[model samples]
Target: MLIAQITDLHVSFDPAFLDGRVAPLEAVLRAVAVLAALDPRPDAVLLTGDLAENGSAEEYAFIRHALGELDLPVFAVPGNHDSSPAMRTGLGSFMRASEASHACYVVDDFPLSLVGLDTSVAGKAHGALDPARLEWLEKVLGQRAGRPVFMFMHHPPFDTGIRTMDACGLLEGRERLAELIAWHGGVVGVVCGHVHRSIHTSVAGVPTVVAPSCAHQIALELRANAPLQYRLEPPAIALHRCEQGQMMVSHVRYIPDFPGPWRF
Candidate 1:
């Protein structure tokens, strides 16, 4: 199975976002176009998080309409810039009913179980997996005992060494989450967004990845106490492919109209 991951769209009704530096809406549309044109289209599209810039209904509505062009199942989780309630209501068609109050749910229709975890904290930049949320995840993982589960969420549990981003990273329940994944032993991979750059690591011995933003990217600054800033870099998406007996493999596909395909 193949899955396409897009993240940090930050779609806003306002065309001039970030002081007119980038157009989040257009950026997402471009990403969508690329996904639509893929030769062998992905089985599903995972909207990791930050689907909107203001968490507004209008923004979500626009995104819904924009994504309607693709004939693929789209799964989404909430990010810091998103309002869970607003997203749930606006993108109801794309999301399934969750037993937990948070926007956490499991998709069982695919070969790989797709688990979406909610890490967005309302009105806060940081993310956390509180006891209740952790409990819900544990229950879900327990139920899917032997299935190869692929988890996706907004914030990454591990530190990226980018001090500013790490300061607001998954601040709670990471250790427990790691333990749960280790205990399950069926989790194939964990995918995340919100760092606005492609990063990879292992959590509980499972490969974990953070997809780059579709609009703007966080500047690669690792200096201590560096200020948080964004750059209008070429947007990108992540493609994850998994086969029966092989581990998942990931590739980063940049979304830009650059020259390519010339004979090497």
Candidate 2:
């Protein structure tokens, strides 16, 4: 099974977002076009978080329309910049109802089980997994025991060393989350998208990935007191391929019209 991951779109109705420094709408459209052109297209698309610049109705509507072009199953979770209520109402078709109040849910229709975690904190840039949400995850994993699961969320459970982003990273319940992944033992991988850059690590012996943004990315500043900054770098997405008895492999596909395919 092939699953495509697109994160931190930051799509806005305004073309001149971020003082016209980044064109998020155009960037996302290009990403979508790239996905559409894939030879063996991904079976599903995962929208990790920050689908909109602001959790506004108009922003959601615009993104919804843009993503509609894919015509493939899309799963999404809320990011810090997103409004849960707005997302549920606007992107209901892309999400399934969750037993918990948060936007957490699971998809079992494909070869790889998918668990989406809602790490967004209302009106805050940081993310957390409260008791209720964690309990929901535990229950889901228990019910799907022995299944190869791929968990996706907005905030990464580990620190990325990017000081500014780390300060606003998953601030709570990460320890417990790591424990859950270890205990489950069937979690194949954990994928996230808040950092806006492709990063990889391991959590509870499972490969964890942070996919790059489809729009601007956070500046790669690891300095001790560096201020938060974004760069209009090349946008990209992640593709995960899964097969029986093999570890899932992920690839980063940049969404730009760079010259390519020259024979070596």
Give the true-structure RMSD of model 2.
3.9
Error of 1 at 206 (Å): 0.6
lDDT per residue (tens digit) for residues 1-264 in model 2: 898999999988775677666778778888999999997989999999999888999888877888889999999999999988998888877888896469999999897789999999898999999999999989998898888889999999999999989989999999999999888888888899999999999999888999999887888888899888877667899998888776668899998862222211
lDDT of each: 0.88, 0.88
Per-model TM-score on C-alpha atoms: 0.95, 0.95
Instruction: In candidate 1, list every pair of residues with a backbone clash.
Output: none
Residue 209 error for model 1, in Å?
0.4
Clashes of each: 0, 0
Off by over 4 Å in 2: 258-264
Predicted candidate 1 versus true structure: per-residue lDDT over 74-153, tens digit per residue: 98999999998899899877777885468888999999899999998888999999998999999999999988999999
Model 1 segments beyond 4 Å from truth? 258-264
The candidate scoring highest on lDDT is 1
- Residue pairs with clashing backbones, model 2: none
